[model samples]
Target chain A: METTPENTAHGYIRAGDKEKLRHRLRRIEGQVRGIQRMLDEDAYCIDILTQLGSIVAATEKVGLLILKDHMDHCVRHAVERRDEADEKIEEVVSAVERFLRV
Target chain B: METTPENTAHGYIRAGDKEKLRHRLRRIEGQVRGIQRMLDEDAYCIDILTQLGSIVAATEKVGLLILKDHMDHCVRHAVERRDEADEKIEEVVSAVERFLRV
Candidate 1:
């Protein structure tokens, strides 16, 4: 595991994952800036709420990506380490619930 | 971008961050298992609520670590790229709100 790349987008980020995350985050970024401009321009409350919801959804996607990576790497490694892996799994399960509930 | 070491704990994880994160997660993992046992033993409602609160706090700590990484890497990089970095900052701001609100 000492051969991981640094910044090739494939190094720390999973293959193809960086592109997807970047694309989504870029969009979210735009939506957020738009919201700020809207607020500056005094847009309606419902409009702002709608934008907030979209931002929330986008943020959730980011959380999911990280969650997937954690499961694939951290949790899986723990499972191979020993029988105590169940505890790790439970932590992840509870985390997912919190993520989704938000 | 291409020099990140793989699995050295320093590859993706910040020098000291992994140790801290792992330690915290280990403790949280134990707490979670204890919660399961408490539930199994039919612990009182307030007891369960307190455990849930602790779990939530632990989760928030994890989230904060990730947020720090994102700001130090992703947001800072975006800022160097151009003025559009403000939007990225806003996205992170909103995400923090969502994180804390939960």
Candidate 2:
């Protein structure tokens, strides 16, 4: 039902996970801002770096969740259709590679 | 010269690099908040996931910068001091493992 991306082939987040993802993102956003504030206040490099580790880990976790949902729903659907199975598999592989590279 | 972190031996960000790190962090903060806002407005999952990738990469990049600075200053200084060389090496190795794990 989403129209903003101009297509129905994307944005396939599961309904239940959407709210959970939103909450996580909001918290991550706050943590990012908090780091900036720490910098502005001249926080320690070690502390800031430590905090940054947490952010990266959190963001990575969120990505994993979305990736799982994609596989569970969208990817599963595509596999069932067989029409876009290769494309979907390739896409998910690429996504996993990106996450791994980080 | 920072007093809050207490007793020094940390917060060793180089003077020249502090502002740069701060600026990068500020932009990253905005990007994070933007993702949250996107969700609040029903942004697509694929789109959000893509955006999340960027955040993870950017945050990782910032962490690398801080790590480099830490090595160049703090770790290097420790290496010069025979007393703390092993400790600093272990500390840096631990940090690297953490970043790599993420």
Candidate 3:
């Protein structure tokens, strides 16, 4: 049987997912560094702000994607098991609320 | 004086920020579509999961970046105005709490 998100006690992501996540984070880290360099160089305030906005949007997209995955995998698994599907769904709702606040 | 985030009635992002955010979101949207395509192709489950994880992390990073910007710009501006710095700070705290939940 395939390992689901709920299979792990801590809800650990699969190895492949973990690797991809690390790579994306590294790239984002670089982007952040670039923004800092621009600031140091006294780049135009508007330009700096623009880059910051990009970073923010990119980050939000990432979060939403993960949330979707969690719902698809973890939540689905929960339903299959006839376990705490409602709780899992509530957790997702809370997560969505948090995502929007950001 | 430069227009700060708080300057707008809706706390509107600057023009440059808005443009960059739109662009970043477009890229992320493409990435999401790619993931869906992979799913349709019956790509390796692990591979799909990995991509999903990357998307999640990227989204979280974007949220954090935006939160930081809000603190540095909007919150700071609020402090200067001596209007609602405390409220702004509390809002940030709540936002952080939400971010970590993801």
Which candidate has the highest DockQ of all? 2
Q: For model 3, how does the per-residue alpha-carbon lDDT over A1-102 read when each residue is reduced to its tens digit? A: 233543434333445664565566556556666654553444433344456555555556555555666766778887999899997777666566544555
For this target, which candidate reaches the highest lDDT against the unseen true structure? 2
Model 2 TM-score on a 0 to 1 scale: 0.81
2 or 3, which is superior by TM-score? 2
Tens-digit per-residue lDDT, A1-102, candidate 2: 233553244556766787898888888878988887776676766667778888988998888887787788777988998867997788778777766674
lDDT of 2 by residue, B32-53 (tens): 8887776566565566677788
Candidate 2 displacement at residue A11 in angstroms? 5.5
DockQ of 3: 0.06
B1 Cα displacement, candidate 3 (Å)? 28
The predicted structure with the larger TM-score, 1 or 2, is: 2
How well is each residue in B1-102 modelled by candidate 3, as lDDT tens digits?
Answer: 233543434433455654565455456555566655553444433345455455555545555555666766777887999988997777667566544544
- Which ten residues in a row are the worst by lDDT in model 1 chain A? A1-10
Tell me the tens digit of each residue's lDDT in model 1 across B1-102: 122222122233354764675566566556645644543443432333345455545545655665676577557767998856987678777776654455
List, residue by residue over A1-102, the lDDT tens digit for candidate 1. Answer: 121222122233354764675566556556645644543443432334445555555555555665676567556767998755997688777766654454
Evaluated on chain A only, model 2 obtains a TM-score of 0.86
